[model samples]
Target: MRTFEVPTRDQVSPEAQAIFDNLKKQVGMVPNLYATIGQSANALSSFLAFQGAQAKGTFNAKEREAVYLAVSQINGCDYCQAAHTALGKMNGFTEEETISLRKGESDNARLDAIVKLAQDITENRGRASEETVEAFFAQGFDNAALIDLIALVADKTLANYVHNLTQIAIDFPVAQPIEEPALV
Candidate 1:
């Protein structure tokens, strides 16, 4: 269970309420994870803002799911892994692909690099090594994508932290859970 009550739209600050309203319009409902974060308007708004900023990454939808799947798995955020697993499917990731990502493997070479980069960020706490970043670009990403990786990492870190703190219920179904942890 969550450590404290998750405020509804009316309970949060006006900014968070507006964000929540927009979220509902876009996604049909504000996710419970978002609801919990809404306890802090800054956090909820920051999460939403980072998501929009990260959309420019070199990682495509499939690639984003790959990175999210890998990082969520490593962070032991079952809720996030589950949510992303479902999204991965919606974004065209196969069951085997999702499995490979959680294992830190990737058939799509470009995404392999992104997944690895996300893992490195998770491990290094934004101080990723030069070699790791070099490998990411060498694999085909550009500087802009590299910059977006920070946003992706920030978004995932936020979600994973929420999951770790509260085993948030998934708003969607997911593939089989990744039992092996790949470290946040």
Candidate 2:
């Protein structure tokens, strides 16, 4: 159960109504995350703003979903992990790839590094190591990519933690849990 009242579909603010409507039409449905966020116009607006900001990247939806799945897995957010796993499949990521992301080991060191660094930065409470930064750079990511990843992290963290706190119903089905990796 959510701590706050989730706006009834009819109760959504005009601004959030438009955003959620657009998302529903395009994505087939307003996600439960968005539904819960619809309770707060500012939070839903912030989520959309972050999405807009991250849209300039060279990373395709698959790569982005990989990052989301990896971080969600590490952070143990069932809502995000399940949601992104479905979206990742829509983006053409294989089940194996999704599972790999959940385990933070998709065979590409670059992505693994991104996932690890993102999780580490989040888990360490924002204390990222120099080596982590260098490793990210070595993976062909530039300063802009770093910034974009930070934006993604912030975006997902808000929704993930919200869902965790709320025990938000999974709008998507349960994805099989991937192995919780030994501390990397």
- Per-residue lDDT of 134 in model 1: 89
| Residue range 1-184, candidate 2, lDDT tens digits | 3265455668888878887888888888888888888877888888787787686775667778887887787677898988998999999888888887777675788788787677766667567788888888999889888878877777778878987788867878788876555143
The C-alpha RMSD in Å for every predicted model, in order, reads 2.4, 2.1
Name model 2 segments beyond 4 Å from true.
1-6
Name model 1 segments beyond 4 Å from true. 127-131
The TM-score between candidate 2 and the true structure equals 0.88
For candidate 1, the C-alpha RMSD (Å) to the true structure equals 2.4
lDDT of 2 at 81: 84
Return the clash pairs for model 2, or none.
Answer: none
Output the number of the lDDT-best candidate. 1
Error of 1 at 95 (Å): 1.8
Which lDDT tens digits does candidate 1 get at residues 70-121? 8887777877888888889899888888888887788777777788888888
Q: CA lDDT of each candidate? A: 0.79, 0.78
Clashes of each: 0, 0
